[model samples]
Target: MSRKLLPDFLARAHDDRDPSPWLALWLDQSTPLPDPVKTAWLADSSSASRQYLLPFLRPLARTVIVLLQVVKVFFPRNWSHSGALHALLVWGLKRFVSPQANWLILRHFHLGSQVLAFIARNSPAPVPTSPLEPTDIDALRDDLFLKHDLNLFNFVIRLNQALRDQGLELHKPAHLDLTMLRDPDLKLEDMPHGRLNFLDLQSAIELFTPLYQLLLTDNDFWRAANSLQLDETIGIYCATLLAAPEHLVLVNNKHPLVPLSTLRAGHRLVIHGLSTEMLHALLMRFKQAQAEGGVVHTTSGDASAQ
Candidate 1:
């Protein structure tokens, strides 16, 4: 079978809700098993002569074990114990223990990482690392301007208040999972390389709406500096996300009359509203800066001016 068939196969195999029919189908197709499954079967078999028989016996053994567990759970005395035990097992599997053993048995091979990749690609909602799209920005703008009847300036002020009220500091260093950036097994680089979609889009919007409002705000300082363009504003936001204090100084420094020291001290720099290009650029800059041992100092401007 094609590798493309793996996601559907695993999904059906692990459907726990109603697994009997799917398990039967999986067993029926065991004769000419998929390459991964067949290889795994042979590797685990004791003898070459028993290779063919292993395919039939393996899934049957699994089904019988599962059925026995199900039957045990049906008994009133065993129900509570079984349910509690199952819950504990799930918790342990997700948190404390590695899932490698379970994956080997469930997938008929040790392809847990591949299976996760397939599920991520086939998921109904997009992953969090995807970029922001133009429509998403437009919708956010409408929500702020039309629905809320709040101009960019007021919106930003409100966003600042909200941030302060919630005690969320925007200038803090961001934590990232580098593993999500690449797939070592497949030699795939930049794993999530696209515009934000569905769930990711919704989440990004929710998190950044306040920051977007801040960007759209028409402050006299930004207007005088002539750096109020969307791209430039977004660049500042990206810099903040990257913890690039130098870039923030470069962008915000345009308004020299507004003391840098006061702005740095009083205003909390924030990040939001990112496109694919914008996010990529930030990551590249961050890496480059780290490589060169660049030193970044916090903004020294007074916050009251912001």
Candidate 2:
């Protein structure tokens, strides 16, 4: 159930960006080799019938090595060297193996960990001594979403601060509509798709200004960017929402303020349409929260507080 909450955009993005051959080769070379025992055993033997015996044993050895690597994926540690050997063998096999197969394995392992991490971090806190009523759940859900948005807002503020520290500035364009950047019908020729070197200020601005705008203005796009920039944060947010004991349906309920539907819709719109001025205001709020060693709490009845 938690896994289902994992965003589809993440999976699509992962599939779309297949690593270049050069990157694959470099990654293979860069991975550390297994310890000496396995290397020595595979390197050669000095028995009388070694030539005939090794040919038969090599396949079994490779299989065992691969299995060990699969185990290491779950239990990462320095105890065994078989996993290292497995990596080397897999890397070697990439040259002869189908690219699709290699990509599938790499993509699954990498993306699986990301999902697991998201689940771990964002799983809901245990219910209090008194189990939460629907209203309590509603408040908690809204609070979590607010926290997630503010966290992203703070991150951008920090990024800007870092840039300033390095004598760089992030210019917020006067007219920015991120929705256009994400139009599915937009032609590839019109897209800013190319190699970018952030070290060059012009290149950085050309690439990131539009990207930052998109992050600010598009909820789906912002969530995807958050997933990439801060892995599983969005997943955790979704998971936390899904983990709510019961979905609030506030059609004719006696809530003091807005309906749950309105609250939800408005929250989404506010996050998606976040402007530079709003972000700066959020940054200030976050700083104050940090200085006070507490969070800025938003009441369930007052959506404006968020």
Candidate 3:
């Protein structure tokens, strides 16, 4: 498949009202695509976008759709790629710098309608019949619920909207279990080797509690930058995990290593995508912490003593 023919194939799929032929040609890129409509086969990948060159969606899309159909019976939310990543990608690709490529990418992913809806106009907020009156039932419920747990400014704003959407005259929805942690085990927010700042201590405890394991993505040891917020910093490291190895590693962004031992299944260890030497240094620190009874957890699993 050549870039020259991908658009043509898509147009052909639309005309034929079936993706099987398009899919066949799609799969054949490195091989040969099968065309049920015209009873033809094509050889070669249609494009060079690395992702397009791969046969990911070509073979898996139909299977994924079938799985989604079954999962839909049990899950209230949509988990289809179209609903999750596809919808998100639709928004992102629509904003892609190249106008033609944006449209093409959406079409390539079969996200045309969502792209159109996004481009059309702003979504409207529902009009409220009344404000938060002091005597109102909703006002009373608001006092009972959503009056705590969240920062006041944002909390009030979200609570008001949720109350309105429920169509209930009462003020609040019941408190949800979302605020609680599912696991009871002790967790470590890894302090980078350098000296710790007081706020970093606070922020680490805040951010790392929920996520027990981290796979470091780069050569750079994560120093808690006084200037940088922990959330943004942690997010950057986590995003790099896709390129990391199957086993948890502490690596500089460019290289990877296999830790000498396996981690216990439940230990909330942060993984760094790091090299062997760096991994050893970090693991040793864990050992010191363990010997000193600094960390509350232990593993008979394979992770090495640093």
Candidate 4:
């Protein structure tokens, strides 16, 4: 039975602009890759590939900066980070990167850190107590950027579906065709490992800003913060889907993800939203869920004892 879980599951308080709840729910609920071995293999392979490939890619990543430098010479002496170049880059991303892939990549950083923060909060062993500032979160982002390819993650999602079609159960062995990823309709949130919330633009910007500073021509970090409208659309769709009252009437129908936003008067910039206090809240919930036989694991295959 599809019972209504939390009425405010997707609703934020009128005064709250905090993006953690949606991001955490998405991380906690993203479909777990079917096998732990696959997870380890992904990490192992991605690490090796990055070590081999980054030397080549680093120069390509630098091409953006070179283009910007040339444009600066030909254009105004006062070309700013928030100027036409930034807009064109954002437009190109929207224009070229598959919408699904774009959403997946940007949200992955926020969700990835949420996964780490969840672990840091729940670890039986003591770890560092310092809050993750923007710089620290940037380090985490850079580490992750070097570790995994998004296409590999996308391929695993397809492989999981193929395994399911063959009646394979979770954690069981299976072999599948790699070509399934070529399907036109695959989406990141379609599988049933758990529920995912939605994407928020600001969350992506928080993690992306540092990389923008390091790789792109925007040496002035403060002025380069930005986001896409696609983030807002996906977020609204997911939030509204879960929050809809129609679920009461159509009890057996698959509920769509839903959306909403609450505007407030105060302004604050969240570098990386994960913090010590947020970790504390996540820890308490993790304990309660563990008591209830629900253990959180990452999509990269950090499984808990069942």
Best by TM-score: 4
Candidate 4 per-residue lDDT over residues 160-239, each given as its tens digit:
45545666423311211111111122233331212222212232232233344444333232222221112222222212
Candidate 1 residue-wise lDDT, 62-109, digit = tens: 444345444544444312222333344333323322122122222211
Residues 1-306, model 3: lDDT tens digits? 224323445445444455545455444422111132111111112222222422433234334334534544564332222123223333332232122222211121111111112111111222211112122112222321111111222322443465468653321122211111111111111111122121111122223221211211111101211101122222222222211222232222221222221111111111211121122222333335546657523221111111
lDDT of 2 by residue, 177-197 (tens): 111111012111221212320
Better of 3 and 4 by lDDT: 4
**lDDT of every model, 2 decimals:** 0.29, 0.28, 0.24, 0.30
Per-model TM-score versus the true fold: 0.22, 0.19, 0.17, 0.25
Error of 1 at 128 (Å): 13
Cα-lDDT of candidate 1: 0.29
Pick the winner on TM-score between candidates 1 and 2: 1
> Candidate 1: lDDT of 243?
43
lDDT at 216, model 1: 30
**CA shift at 128, candidate 3, in angstroms?**
29
Ranking by TM-score: 4, 1, 2, 3
CA shift of 108, model 3, Å: 12
